[model samples]
Target: MPYKPIESYGVIGDMHSVALVGMDGSIDWCCLPHFDSPSIFAAILDDEKGGHFQIVATHEASFKQMYLPDTNVLLTRFLGAEGVGEVCDFMPIHRDKHGNRNGIHQIVRIVRAVRGSIHFRLSCRPAMDFARREHEVVLLPEGAVFDSEGQDVILLSPVPLKEDGKGGVTAEFVVEAGSCVTFALRHADDWTARNDLLSMAIDGEEARSRTVQFWRDWLSKSKYEGRWREMVNRSALVLKLLTFEPTGAIVAAPTTSLPEEIGGVRNWDYRYVWIRDAAFTLYAFLRLGFTEEATQFMEWLRARVSEHDGPSGPLQLMYGIDGRHELPEIDLSHLDGYRGSHPVRVGNLARTQLQLDIYGELIDAVYIYDRHAKRISYDFWCDLRRMVYWVIDNWEREDEGVWEVRNGRRQFVYSKVQCWVALDRALRIADSRSFPIDRPRVIAARDKIYETIMALGYDKERQTFVQVFGENALDASNLIMPLMRFIAADDPRMLGTLDETLKQLVSDSLVYRYELEKGSGLGDGLTGKEGTFSICTFWLVEALARAGRHRQARFIFEKMLTYANHLGLYSEQIGHSGEALGNFPQAFTHLGLVSAAFYLNRVVGKE
Candidate 1:
């Protein structure tokens, strides 16, 4: 099979891990057990070697995919010359009494003929450990089991299977209208064909009904009744799926090594949780009235921060879902990257880099959470206080900004502005919540940050803020200054900077992070070009709407919506030709969409 476009897939998850189901009824990319677990099928990255499970029809047909209304259950329809058939795909989500997702890790597929008689072919191929490890299959009367070194995966179905030319199993079946088949792929437990397969398959329909209810019940917490309710709700659903429920750590995306540029060396693993991205997601959750998630993440953040060594700050930039901090970057060179993008990478090295902006993002999230969700415990306040002091002491330091550029640290303008934001929010929290803070010391440090940014970060000649303290290069991240409340949106300086960004960094409603071409001399210490950053484009929409340019913001917002995939999903970036160029169902981009839609819709509704 050929590689499908990144956007040609819909995602289904149980808040632990996700699977990318292609339009052709194939499970092309999935990391079982957990989002960061080794891939069970990575055929999207290397179609020849990586394994996939497919249940496609035998007859020639066109395919259409959609989610069941208000739920993550995906339904793919086969418009065939012989008969009409549909496949329902979902990962069953079982909730505890407290409404938390605590269930088995599995994928359930239901194949049914919607019209006349239809013929179907089922293929099950398992490639453990990102397809680098070999496995043996044990055929059974109930189903088949793919046994790896120690981990085993079982595919339980009602049909008979046989080994194929490749080390996989295949089956064929024909069914008339009103008939169906069920398949469940899950991690092996004590249950076997004699004990559980029959009952599990029998419970497939009940499980599907339960999973759909779980999602709908969760989505009922949304308070948004906006002009683009569907889009906002979809983004909310994507954010919820990316959330790691066990610890409340939200992943940036499920799959990794999906390049920012096709065949370019920009691919990096995003399965881990970054503090800044999670903070952004927190804001979205709070806005949509998902306070339970916000409260859970705050607890996660407090516990994670307590584990950090108290030298420079209270937390690292990112961490594993289970709170592991030592994320060493590794290159998986054997498996061909998506579209042969070389040197597929697994851990993130940027965690070790000094990203001072995280303090601002983290504290800002705390402030919002404290205001909108619930009061923070004194213990949580103590953890945040240490981080505030750290910012006061180190806000003048040069470090990676929000973009996490590879270029050697300079006095990035965005970083300094965020430092100002950290102190400003701290002051607000102290006043509002009666928390004890070093009033005089923090105020002095906050004033110094603001003064330094205005003097050195601004370029008087260009009438705009520059990327670095002493340079005039424009960056899309500075578009966030007003949104952070560090500057007024309609201020003359901010307006000038906004114009400079549109002229220098934006094209056709898509915004690039920074100039990638060397002639611009804004080198990020990386080679090759990249797509327009989708998160920043939404940031622009929010910024423009807040600036009172309602018409311009609405137009840009509408145009960007066209770039979404058929399922209303977005990746990290958009390629030059409008293809999704980075990891699919990106949480950062989805949260941006929610934020933009909320702010834009609010202001427009008032008019």
Candidate 2:
């Protein structure tokens, strides 16, 4: 089989983990148990060694794929000259009467002939531990099981199957119109547990109905009834899918090591939860009236803060879905990387880096949640107060900014501005709740940050705030100044910064994080160039709209939407040639889309 383009896939998940299903009816990327679990089928990263489960049509067929309306149930239609068949794929959301998702981890596929008789071929190949560990296959009455050292995968189907002679299963079947077959891939700790669950025959139609209702009911809670409702709703759905329901910690993306530059070494694992991303996601959920999600995340954040060891600061930059702090980076030397982008990495090392800006984002999210969702508990406020004091004491220090630049830390202007945001929002929360916060000290610290950034972070000659102090280079992150209320959007300084960013960092409305020209002395501790950052581009749209450039913001926002994949999904970045370049279905990109749409709609009176 040939490799599919990164964008040629749609995602389905159970809010615990996700699977990337290709249009060709193949599940190329799926982390079995959790979002960060080792891949059982990873042909998306390495087509040759990585395993896959495919149910493609035997005859030559054209494919059309879509999600069932207002739901994540994916339907991929295989149209052949003689017959038309469709495969509906979804992870059943088993919820109780209270609308909480029970821990049901399984992928269900219903194959049916829509037209005449159609022949289909099914292949079930399991490569446990990223194909690094070998497994044994056991034939079962219902289907087959792939048994590994610590885990077992059961593939159950009504169709007959034969051993593929390569420790896998293959089946061929024909179905006439009105006939259908259901297939399920389930993970278990042991065979007995798997058989116990499989004993209860899963009704395909009932499961489909339940899944559809779950999504529709959840989406009904959305408060957004504005222009671009479909796009905004879809982005919200993607964000919800990326969330790890058990902990309320959302992964940046499901799959990791998808290169930002094709065959380039810029890839890093994004499966961990970055505090900045979680905060932004919480803000988005709050905006859409999903207060439940915000509350869950706030609880998670409080727990993480409580676990902090004082001197090391409030929280790590990122953490595992279960809130584990130690995520050591490792390279998978055995399997070839995506397009041979060398040294496939797992477990981001940036967790240990000092990213001071996360404090601002986290505090800002708490402020939004406190105002819109619910009141913060007094105990949680005490923990947050410690973090706020930490920020006040360390606001002058330089650390990694929002971009998490690997190069040595400098006095990043955005970081200082965010420190200001932290104190400013902290003051608001204190005032609103009548909490006895240190008013004078926090106010002085906040004002000092603003003054320092204006004096040292700005380049008077270039008429723009540079990426760091004493550097003339521009960065798209500085555009957040107005969005954060650090400066008025139309203020002469901010306008100059915006104009300089538009001239240097933007290419045809797509925004780059920074200028990456060689010998420019601004490399981010990595070789090769990268794509236009999707989140930064959307940030530009919001910045422009805030600056009263509504028409221009709408134009750029509409253009950026066109860059989303056929299924309205976006990755971390978009290449110069307009291809999605990093992890697929990135939460940050979709969050940016929702934020941009919210602001643009309001400015254009579509709210």
Q: Pick the candidate with the highest TM-score.
A: 2
Once model 2 is optimally superposed onto the true structure by TM-score, how far is the C-alpha of residue 107 displaced, in angstroms?
Answer: 0.4
User: Each model's C-alpha lDDT?
Assistant: 0.88, 0.88
lDDT of 1 at 559: 96
Candidate 1 lDDT for residue 392: 89
Backbone steric clashes in candidate 2, count: 0
The lDDT of model 2 is: 0.88
Question: lDDT (0-100) at residue 531 of candidate 1?
Answer: 93
Candidate 1 lDDT for residue 228: 91
| Candidate 1 residue-wise lDDT, 1-607, digit = tens | 8889999999999988999999999999898789998889999888878889999888999999999988999999899889899899999998778866545688999999999999999988878888788888888777887877656788887889999967689999987898888899987534453245434554678889999998999999999998999998899999999999889999999998999888888898999999999999999999999999998898888887677664335677889999898889988888898999977888999888788888889889999999988988888887778878888878878887777878778888888888888999989999998999999999999999999999998989989888888887888898899999988999999999889889989999999987665234756777788999999999899889888998889899999999999999999999989999988889999999999998998787443
For candidate 1, the lDDT comes to: 0.88
- Among all candidates shown, the one with the greatest lDDT: 2
